[model samples]
Target: MRRKHLLNTFAAAALRIFMLLTLGVMMTLETKADISEEYPDFYTGAEGTNTKGINFVQSITVLAPEYCSSVMGDFTVVFKAPGMKYIKAFCWRQPTDKNPGKWGHDAVLADMELKEGEMGKFVVKGDEFPNGPMTIRIHAKDDKNKQDICELQLYNLGGVKWNQGIPDRDPPGAAGMARVFADDFDGPLSISPDGMNARYAAHKTGGGDFSGWQFSDPHGENQPFAQRDTFLRIHASKPLGTQGRSGILSSLRPDGTGVAVSIPSYFECRFVAQSAPGTWPAFWTLTKNTIGMDKNDPTFEKISKMGSDELDIVEAYGGYGHKNPNSGGVYSSVSHFWGQPKPDWNQRKLADGSENTDFKPSSFRTDTLQLGGKSSWSWTFHTYGLAITETDTIYYFDDIEIGRHPTGEVSKALPAWFLINYSIGGISGWQIDMERYGNKTDMWVDFVRVYSGCVQAPEVSASGFPGAKPAVVTMSASTRGAEIRYTLDGSEPSEKSTLYTSPVSVSQPCTIKVRGFGKNLKPSPVTEYILTTPPGVQGSIGINFVTDMADSEQALAPGDVTGIAPYIQGNWNNVLAGTKTTSRFSTSDGATSPVTLNIEGEAKPEKGEPWGFSGNDRRLKRGNLVSNPRFTLAGIPYAKYDVVVILGAGIHNVQGEIHLAEAESGNHIDAFSFDYGWNGGQHAIATTKPGEAAKNTNYIVFRNVTQKDITITMKWGSGKGWTGVAAIQIVPQKD
Candidate 1:
């Protein structure tokens, strides 16, 4: 065993050296020639409508000699509509016999959106289109509703030939829970619902607008960027093309067949909530076959009872009325069987065949889950999932089990398809304040996944996978061939982010996050590996704590590192639990009112780094704090190199002075301070304002004047205040 371990270590060292030498070369590989030049007539025709007076399609060319049908994550869609703004394009495998209009049931090869006359270069991921006789549609719209489109050509990057090599994607979940259904809405919700019911019909309760909700924007903005996200927004608004309206999407296929799953499965979707008072967003499943039909008919009741099984995985309107308990964001789930009682046709029945009219206790029941904060559901993406088994049905928020129900007869009910709607003004008596909430509310969906067969997510065991070596952890792909992307700060991976070409090297105990990417495979779940350092692996020790729990940065003094406030008040507990964009690390101050400053991951250093902490948990972000922001720390020096601070945030054209001082002697050492004047000087990373639509705030590197071993304090401030500084690592370097 010892010999093998030594051999593994040496192998790892060799691999690392090899990769270091080859990485630069790999990054420099150029894209192959255009498919249009290589494969002529890939596209037979292209057209544009509603463009006022402009020709929408710039050009259409083919790359491979064949069509793209089942090929994705391995091809690129290239096009341009320079004459028009707001382009919405869809590329699909159009069959030789089926016309473009009949392309409904066929899979969408790609969904691309371009805003403000942008080029197609930013429209889609490289080589993501499938192989087949392709049909392309470009819906270009102006701010005033004028539309246009342009033909697209394929550009091959990575020299990926169809079927020449395998596709890279997230592995499917484990067996029994393996994925049975899935859609990122990469295109439109091609599947239609059974029929229009009361939910689809406009409700008078809050003057709701039915038919107002939409799928991917025909006007752009629905495009998820590779580095961030591309999602479909279910928007609720006061009539644009018409009047006050809400949105609804049925899961029934337009071909008349229902989309209900025939077996027990899980339905999961990541949604950005529209949590205002008047807005009601929900993810629910119903008996697709029986919906919009008469429940009073006995035959309908018996055979259709199979169709009336309804599961409300999430109803966001539950937070209304109960101000205290429901103060924070909350959702409700209910189970219902519309099989009416034998004699009482007006009442619904339970699994046991009983009828309860007044309380309707058995007819329908609800379970509520408080989401902790009022704004909890409004800002970020949270997953709501329904796990349906033969005997059990469960609801989840961000993967944590929230409510459960016996499968009873409902579990035995027919298959169900998901219906996502942004509703409003129902008669349920929830609060309605559209005037206060505004005329427009948006609900964004990242993806919807349905699974059965006891499938679990890909097992990401640091121990089990091959490439078994010290400091190297391999993630198990779901038996399906795929490539994985990873991050250290817990954010989900994006196509634009770094690709995991090989197992990562971890010198610190930071969290390494992994996610799979596959072309035709199911959605790959993000798996986090929380590495623990060996006792001997500890780096240089330094004090870490939160200086304040307020929204603003507090002044840092020599003794304020620990003694200034109790640890409890610092709200250090947040770092202990992590959930990607949420959770933070802090030093609490008990004397304070258990106050906390929230700093999501990426904004702070790994838990073990010396001086690794957000100063104000509530101030998890210091990039925008401008009023003399200061940070102080004292520790045994890690080395005698010059002081250099690595800062991660957005500071495009900002200038500031960073001050460094010796904490114990209160001495401003040699070459103590440097003024950060970006936009012209050498920049490590430059970006726009922080917390805005822009990414990263880009990391900034500053070389300090002094180098020493004594505990040090550093501060950055500008007359305009500060940009965001998510986290700072004091690395040893002079340049």
Candidate 2:
């Protein structure tokens, strides 16, 4: 990082922050296909204004997507620069670091001029770097300040050879890419006949040294990855030990992923530095273009030395405990390893004929970032990320950026495989430094999220009215040739999760979680839809509002028993303490005398018990309102339909009550009574219904709880003039 380029670079960086905040980007876990369509404009930078006459790179604006990790792909970046002659671009990880352009700060790498009159453009074709999010600093060759270039737009034509060898299903094969594969290494790793895997290693059949590492979950602990306290422990063996534990990519089959392996991909993972004298934790990727070497055999070293590309996102040095001296120091670097440096062919060999130190690309790191800004690596967990493509590669830490570079070297021009592991003694570094480190240590990883590939998850929407039960909802995806997978249990969807082939019928209030997947693309981010069906209700229920008749407005409407959005509806005014005298009328079948409430001698409330209705009688607040009749009927079709009335909370201290009703056939029905302590909630006053299922299960069933209907005149036997009320649920007893 240099001193002179601080203000200008950071200013541009500030603009990028603003863009990420306002733009809507697709935050994916597994991805493939077009990076631009999968995420947002943050991958290509902010759209610059038409303001021309610009020369310096400071005049350019960047608003790329928050993430873009296309390890191999072709895309075109279009820009308008009427007065621009030549363009030079530079990118360094640290905003404060000045060694930005790999070809110095004044080299012209991409030309932006064409004949007499034409807009300039930068084409990142298939022949580029490993993968994504390159922070480009472009300037005109003629002007010292790039002020002539105005607008910029990027259109990703999808990555080249994204997933080549995998057998594509016939007909509607893999129409969508739901989270088909992912492994937190939490529960026991499951190997099956269907070939679903999340953990892998090249040499040891995707399990590293076969037994060096183990997946552990003590039945008593509260974690799989419970923050710093508890997490998946990938413990390592002795130094120079054969095993290396890792996870992240799913294609490390011992059989090899032929040429054109994975599509342009985004790789990310969070890991705590190893704690021990002989521990080293790392997250890295390898280019698929390794033609001469075999990843598992001893001959790999010699072959890789000839020519190979590997990107080390993070490689912590050996460390012990949380101590600084034993840990991987205060910073980590993003290095690109491409064969040995010029004339360094013998660097891969050992004097004793035993494999020794291989050439370390420490001197050629694209960018280096200070860990926790001057903190030890093993002390905490940090995120390491890399987005690479054929033409450029970008690095990130904790979601923020490290820097980017052009595909200047040939090794960076190929697609790559991913890897995550805990190793002890390796090439140029970590040894069993027992003096400062502990003998046995473990790497605790929170979780790893790879944001590569693209899957336009389904967008859910509900249609029809709330009054209808078993609501009909549809799930659609914006990605072409995508299918939706969904669940109603509030759990995330995977390839094995329930597949949504058509409109869904939701019979209760539930959360509908869905994801979209395309043939070759990764699954889209999860989209949660909360669906609720308003209970079928009849006329409006009255309320006991404490407000005076003068101040309170229309709190109750005319209706025998109305219903809508919820189980009950009413206003407070109708239930005022002394607003209306307690009186009940007989059913229309026969003219029976009305009954008056026998007010108990000013009911005494327990000294400490607060009144259900709060506030003074003169004010119309929430506390001063109660449902009228202290109860109400809730159902529809107004005919002779059976149902059940389940007493809710409002009956705690209710006094005595009675009900006289006539059956629908004009015959006298059974009388009902309630003792002083027996009231609302936990009490079901069952009525006769047609056919019914087990009532023990949960569901807001409105049909089939009762068999017949009755009209009744119910009166309070004892209590103040006002009736205490809670909820009155009327579920249809007969479906």
List ranges where model 2 is wrong by over 4 Å: 1-182, 190-198, 202-230, 238-251, 256-263, 290-307, 319-328, 334-374, 408-413, 434-438, 453-735
lDDT of 1 by residue, 1-735 (tens): 000111112222221211121112121111221223222422111121111122112222223322212234544445554444443444433223343332122233334445644555323333433231123433343332222322222222322122211113322222245454455645533321112111121111112223322222111122211111234545455533434545555555322222345445677776655444445677777655544335684656666544356677776552222111122233456776556323233246645777644222222212222232212343334567777777566777655676665564645655566677766544343444444223455565667666654212333333211112234555544323456667777677665556766656555556777766655444454566666432211121112223232212322221112111111111122211122222122221111121122323223332111111222321232223232334443332334333323332233333433444564475765222223333221223423222223222223333343433233233343334234333333333223
| lDDT string, candidate 2, 67-165, tens digits | 112223654444444444554432212211354332122112264444434555564542332111222334443322222222121112232221112
What overall lDDT goes with each candidate model? 0.38, 0.37
Candidate 1 Cα outliers beyond 4 Å, as residue runs: 1-175, 186-229, 239-242, 254-258, 290-302, 305-307, 318-327, 340-375, 436-438, 454-735
Q: Quantify how close model 1 is to the true structure by its C-alpha RMSD in Å.
A: 28.7
TM-score of 2: 0.30
Best by lDDT: 1
